[model samples]
Target: MTAKVENRDFTADLNNKSSKAFQDFEREFKQQMAELYQSITSYRGVEIHSLRNGSVIVNYTVLLEVPATATANSTVQGISAELVTIVNSYLNCCQSNPACGLCFNASFTEVTSAKADSVDEDLCDGQVPEGFEDYYSPALTALGVLCVTVCDKRAASPYRCVHGTCSVERSGPRCECSERAAFWYLDGSCASRLSKLGVAVGVPVAALAVAAAAFAAFLLRARRQNLEYR
Candidate 1:
């Protein structure tokens, strides 16, 4: 299915130390974020960027199946406001709870026209973007993203992580090359930063070398067998 990209921008700063607080919110509000995301109609995926000064820039991009039936301007406005509301509510919840110890001033940065389209609907819906199921938390009781990074095919390339998935736990997007890490996320998908280039190159070369060695061994065995029979 063809999809469109709609970006709603917002910025917020941490109330506590930047590093720990960011991680805490990601862990604590993960489920809330997932649920809040579902409220949007053509829910594609989200990307968040961290700045040097501790303020964060969030990019929530949706891939609409077709051109929006509603006017693009109004749709952008409505969706942007909805996102801000969702984030603010989550932050407020954090404030009330001491364990979270998180606070941030969030406000809209810009609302883009909802005209961005992609035939590759997987864009920003995570690495395996064909289905909606890959985007959210799996367990009903606990909270977490199914994939580390969701790609907006229009903006970033799909991750080909060998070991770990793309995660957004740090300053920028990187591949996570750890064991048993299923899917990677971009905006928050920082499990590891190893490139697909390495894997794409390494595996085949290793296999070819093994195959050549095996072939040489088979030839040597056949030659010995023929000599003995003669």
Candidate 2:
């Protein structure tokens, strides 16, 4: 629908995470746009930077040239909104693992002139982090990027769970502990929850055992002395 031109610039202070995320955003954005709108062209690259609040900002420009024969929503604002929604959803999904404290905002500009800067590095080398597929699929599906299928329902105001299994419902994903689940599921993995629980429970039991053994020894010694005296 629209001619797409992709371009990006990153300052020197960008970290590995922001760098990787910027690359992923560009690649995913293009694919998502292609799926949602069939007539995009001149795919520009992306610019990534960090904010003082640990938020990552990604800004990009794409030229949308929708053909008269296409069927999807061809307006620039509509495509821009879709792009922002998908990017934000993916960023949210990324936050599920390792608990990255990142907020994302994307702005799209209509490409008006040719730029001299060019970014030609490999942007698609990294793989999606674990535990995000569950979040990623449904979010994109909600927009028009992926085809629809049965999805895990989100919860209604799911409690933020640490070191626990998360329940999927309509509201959002919530975490809970299973019968054998370890403590601190909030950290994503069991980590030391089971061991910590064991230590907590075992220390008291051990102390009681030692106390019982000492009492039994005292009784045995007293009995022996009384018998000898008799």
Candidate 3:
């Protein structure tokens, strides 16, 4: 059986698709922001559901999974970066525009409270590690009123093959892959592709070579036996 090969060309195709996916995300995010801005005036009392310390709690629950691509060339990172930019811009606007105070304060408080609640829930669930309260409390408190909440699915690298598998890492908001599986470290995902492809190709070739050698040996023995009988 010629190892059922699904043309690896799909890698490039998948990369293209991934790029398009990210582009779509960017467009959708912008559209959503435009709508959010129009609907929720900056002066309106927008309640912040998750605030801790000074920083607003950015809950990433809104965006869960980013579309994966075979090559990992996606617009997810760019879109996420853009989102950070938007958040920063919004925060700056809030700081500069006194009219934004009411909305900003409310949102900030809500975010902090939500984060506190999340921490509390984690503790109840036993998800909070030892010394976590001490570490998180001060950090959360220090965030204070002026802090910003960056809520997004997660930051990720464009290359997926370099990263063996995608999972959430505790260090900030990014998808993480195992060290052994990762090609490079950037937002927890691997960034290399050439190395990953090399390994994938090498394994199949090695298997084919072993099979060929065994077949040749069997053929040689059969030929010798037939000659001796003749």
Candidate 4:
């Protein structure tokens, strides 16, 4: 993107054009481009600059990032040759079996980008998530990332925490609910509370269940004694 090779996206131009041949291959062209991408694994991507001259002329560039084993095999060049062929084929392809003059042009640009396997996993620059305010994520520096998203925990107020308190941690902000003795908060929001009446009623019902089991055991014992006497 920094290179800014093209003025604008040319695919958009083809989409707006009112040409019969363009309309015929519009869907297949996308599929063909995707298939082309699947073949090349070492390069950056195919940057389509513009598709002009009735969708027959293609202007594009492929960015190349050098590998550790540079040119060790012919995989890169072989695929590049196929890319040229496939792109040209898409340009001339039409459903009506009519000839539409099409040509393919590609520019190869070498970029000194990061290694293919090294991915930046740090999310220190990530934004404060929804329902949180006062984003204070540390900017990435040469040393390392200090912290990720840090919401305003000092005074999160009724806006962020509602009826709870907020605290910042490595994983971001957490909400601690504050509920009354006879009530408990629902979920972690602490906005809604349910009365402890159900808990109070459950105690006696559980005791009754135990008493019924004991009575059944005594009746079984009595029946066993009668059978022995017989």
The lDDT leader among the candidates is 4
Q: Please state every model's RMSD to the true fold in angstroms.
A: 22.8, 21.2, 25.3, 18.4
The superposed Cα distance between candidate 4 and the true structure at residue 98, in angstroms, equals 30
Candidates arranged by lDDT, highest first: 4, 1, 2, 3
Clashes of each: 29, 38, 22, 0
Best by TM-score: 1
Indicate whether candidate 3 or candidate 4 has the larger TM-score.
4
Greater-lDDT candidate between 2 and 3? 2
Q: Encode model 3's per-residue lDDT on 1-230: one tens digit a residue.
A: 00111111122222242466334433443343454345322212122122122222222222313223321223333333343433334432344443332122322211111111112212222333443222121112222211111222221222233454542234433444555552434443455433556668889999999999999999999999999999
Checking candidate 4 for backbone clashes, the offending pairs are none
Q: Candidate order by TM-score, highest to lowest? A: 1, 4, 2, 3
Model 1 bad stretches (over 4 Å): 1-30, 49-52, 55-77, 89-91, 96-98, 106-114, 118-230
| Residue-by-residue lDDT tens digits, candidate 1, 1-230 | 11111121123433333666555544443444556568676565543333223333433344433243224445555676666566555444353444543343444334454553323333334444344434322111123112333332222345444455555333444565553343333433443444566667879999999999999999999999999999
Question: Candidate 2, which segments miss by more than 4 Å at Cα?
Answer: 1-12, 15-53, 68-74, 91-230
Model 2 over residues 72-137: C-alpha lDDT tens digits? 333444556554554444333343343432333333223333322211122112333443323333
lDDT of each: 0.45, 0.42, 0.34, 0.48
Local lDDT at 33 for model 3: 45
Query: Model 3 reaches what TM-score against the true structure?
Result: 0.21
Say which prediction, candidate 1 or candidate 4, comes out ahead on TM-score. 1
Q: What would the C-alpha RMSD of candidate 3 be, to one decimal place? A: 25.3
